[model samples]
Target: MLSVENLVVSVRRGPEIVRDVSFEIAPGEILGLVGESGSGKSMTSLALMGLLSPGIDITGGAVRLDGTDITHLQPHQRVARNCGKVAMIFQEPMTSLNPVLRIREQLEEAINVHDPRAGPERARELLDMVRIPDAGHQLNAYPHELSGGMRQRVMIAIALACRPQVLIADEPTTALDVTVQRQVLGLIRELCDSLHMGVLFITHDLGVVAQLADRVAVMYAGKLCERADVGPLFRAPLHPYTNGLLACLPDPESGNAAFETIPGAAPRPGAIPEGCPFSPRCNRAQETCRSGPVPEAHGPERQVAVCHFPVRQEAPA
Candidate 1:
């Protein structure tokens, strides 16, 4: 449903924030973009949505939605073709939803933006579709009156108010408790299944990706490190950064203790390393890792890894 090719984005007077990142999502498929903070995960999403700040520019690459190039379109033009066709649920619910507006007003605004003829009744119906009980009464409730989970749900309701074809959820469950987080995630998965919506789920949590994505893309220092199916990526991560991220996830089968973390910090923009951006923190790094451009290798189903030495799965001892 969406294809991004060699997308290079940067801010004016600043280093690139998103390097040659690329990926594709088919209808009803969820593609998870996983990385640590400052890994350029969110920046890529914003770029795709054409919502980047004033200073940022798409230095290179194209974002095609259903084979239509949308890279150079004006903001309003993008909305006309892609608004209801592609919707996004931002990371923070508290700030995403308008504090001054009532839930009904917010949702109806979305509906009207996409279909001006939609009335109050249609807005209430959307609330019910998102499983909000007493949908009619809650329409008058302001964002501040709702709990974090409810607000998140309201955001989802608004995003789905237009019945979008693709849903870009950027850390949709970051603020809620574990139980509520699970509920929200479940709702997203259920909705995707029922609506046959394509999803680009951006998050730092590997566990969430494991449970939610069909394919996974790992990014580091603004570049894509690896891309593979969820099963193969989790069982055997090809890139050093992907392995490090998996190592950091707590393994219940090994007890509840924290897993080993990758050492060192992510490089800041304009400070990325000469060769491999992850070499400083990667245990498997070799001398050559610091001296040359990493080569891209393609595996089954176009799985790609940008590394000098990709990891291979080992047989059981």
Candidate 2:
């Protein structure tokens, strides 16, 4: 339902935050964008939604929703055609929702933006769709009055108010406790299945992606390092970085000890390494890895890995 090609985004005084990243989401499919913090995941989401702050620009590439190129459309123009069609659930619900407005008012505003005639009843129904209890009673409550999970539900309600075709959730579960996180994610999956909505769910949490995504794209230092189906990725990740991430996940079979962690930190914007951005930290890095350009397409399904020495699956031990 949405496609991004060679999408590059950069800040005025910084190096590119997103570099030539590309992916597509089909209707009813959830494409999870996974990476470490500062890997440009959130920036990519904002760029796709035309929500980037001032001083950032779409320096290159195209964003097409259902075949129409929307890369250069003015912000207001894009909003008119694409805003409601592609909604977003931001990472932090508290700051995302208007603190001054009651839950009902915020939701009603969202509905009115797309369908001005939608009344209070329609707003309440949207709340019910998100499974929020006693929608009427919660309507008059301001953001502060609601718990973290409840506020998130309200955000979901608002994002779905327009019956959006695509939803871009940027770390939608980051602030909630484990129980609430599962609920929010389950609600999202249910809604997507029921509405046939496409979603680009951005997160650093591999566990979340493992549960929700059909396909996973791993990003590093502003570029896509690997993209694969969830099963293949978990079973036999082809990139060293992908393997590193998977290795970090705690294994119950390993006695619940802290798992192996990827070495080093994500590079800051202007300080990215010359070759593979992950080269400095990658255990498999060789001289060629530090000099060659990122790899292009490597498999069927257009699975791309930007590593000169993409990992091959090992034999069963």
User: What RMSD does each model have against the real structure?
Assistant: 1.9, 1.9
Q: Best lDDT goes to which candidate?
A: 2
| TM-score per candidate | 0.94, 0.94
Candidate 2 Cα RMSD after full superposition onto the native fold (Å): 1.9
- Once fitted onto the true fold, the runs of candidate 1 whose alpha carbons sit more than 4 angstroms away are 81-84, 255-258, 299-302
Pick out the ten consecutive residues of candidate 1 with the lowest summed lDDT: 75-84
lDDT of 2 at 250: 88
Candidate lDDT scores, in order, read 0.86, 0.87
Q: What's model 1's lDDT at 17?
A: 91
Give lDDT tens digits, candidate 2, residues 92-125. 9878888898898888877877777876699889
Q: Write model 1 residue lDDT over 134-213, tens digit each, in one string.
A: 88888999999888888898999988876777899999998789999998999999888889999999998888999999
